[model samples]
Target: MRRYGPAVLLLLTGAAILRISLLSELYLRYVQAGLRPYLVVSGFLLVLLGVAAAVAGRREQEPHGAHGGHHAPRIAWLLALPALALLLFPPPALGSYSAGREAAQRAAQGVGAFPALPAGGPVALTLAEFSSRAIYDSGRSLTGRTVRLTGFVTRDDDGTWYVTRLLVSCCAADATTNKVEIRGADAPPADAWVTVTGTWHPKGSLGTDGAWPPVLDAASVRRVAQPANPYERR
Candidate 1:
């Protein structure tokens, strides 16, 4: 058991990541929906490697010396660091702190027309889609259209505020913000979820390299609890 400590620890680590990713929040901080299969495969592989190592380690008997000191190869110990850290401090889903620390914006979406809103009342759009229209399409798609948008509040040092969401290309490491300047009311507290009903600000400008997220002339803002699925794909 002593010699197999590292191997057993690894098995636990892989199992934890696998279990949490499927049954809890672990998947939110890393990878898009498409990468779920890869994560599953990797977790299984890690578990297999760990089990194999444990079996092999158990069969080996290190020669004991007269000095009465136990010596065993500890190379596998390094693998536990990441697993331990994860167990102690699981990575959180992206939100205000992430938004605040990340670059204010990222590459603008490709300049092209957006698909027409679905037929109904005010169309609902994810923050990424709304931001693309606001930034790359010059708000043409949003002009004169009342829409519903939902995200958490984030504020600038200057007291300007935004309705913001994050898009994860692969994982939190590459996540980027989709933000819209909020006008016509005070922004709810940072990280507070809200649904905004609004039209695009007629005077909004499309900006360079996504530097300027477009403005929304909010008609109403309603605070809500965070949704179970907090992040969405681009």
Candidate 2:
């Protein structure tokens, strides 16, 4: 077993990757959907390499004293533990904890006219879009229009809570926070997924610090299962 440690580590890690990217949509928790094919390829190659290494190791003749003098380091075996964990129990998507750590850091965008909302009933929007329109749209596109947004709940030290989502350009490692302060509805438990329907509660001047984070006066807040792809594309 010790002699095959490298191959075991590679195989385990590759299987874990394939378990998430190829067998299920769980990969979406950590990366953009567009990168799925690359993950699949990477996992496949790693498995192939592991098999090759194992076969090669088995065929090579070791000198009689080789095993007596130098042993495979114990630390190498420990490296497989994470791969085993990932294979059996993958990590959950980024949630309120990640959101709570992020400060309100809105990108500067000039206040400009946003396209008109679709006519009629409540429109579903990602938290990123809702935040952008509420903060920078000169036309006040969200005013008087009911909108629905879905995200996990996060709270501030002051007891103010937000319906928050993370925005990722490539993967969770690069994720930035986007959230809307819920004015009327009670906050669900931290990291609880929910959909809130409401109208924009405009405050402060457009495109200013006072206008940041955005606010919603939620008329109805309904608990929902977390979406398959929790991160919004940036």
**Judged by TM-score, which candidate is best?**
2
Off by over 4 Å in 1: 66-81, 104-115, 204-211
Q: What would the TM-score be for candidate 2 when compared with the true structure?
A: 0.95
lDDT of the candidates, in the order given: 0.76, 0.90
How well is each residue in 1-234 modelled by candidate 2, as lDDT tens digits? 555777888999999999999999999999999999999999999899899889988987766655552444576788889999999999999998888788887756788999998999699999989988999999988989999999999998888999999999999999899999999877788999999999999998998889888999999999999989999997
Task: Report the poorest 10 consecutive residues by lDDT, candidate 2.
Answer: 64-73
Residue 74, model 2, lDDT: 78
- lDDT (Cα, tens digit) per residue for candidate 1, span 94-160: 8899888877664545666777776765888888777777776743777778888999999988999
Residue 223 displacement in candidate 1 (angstroms): 3.1
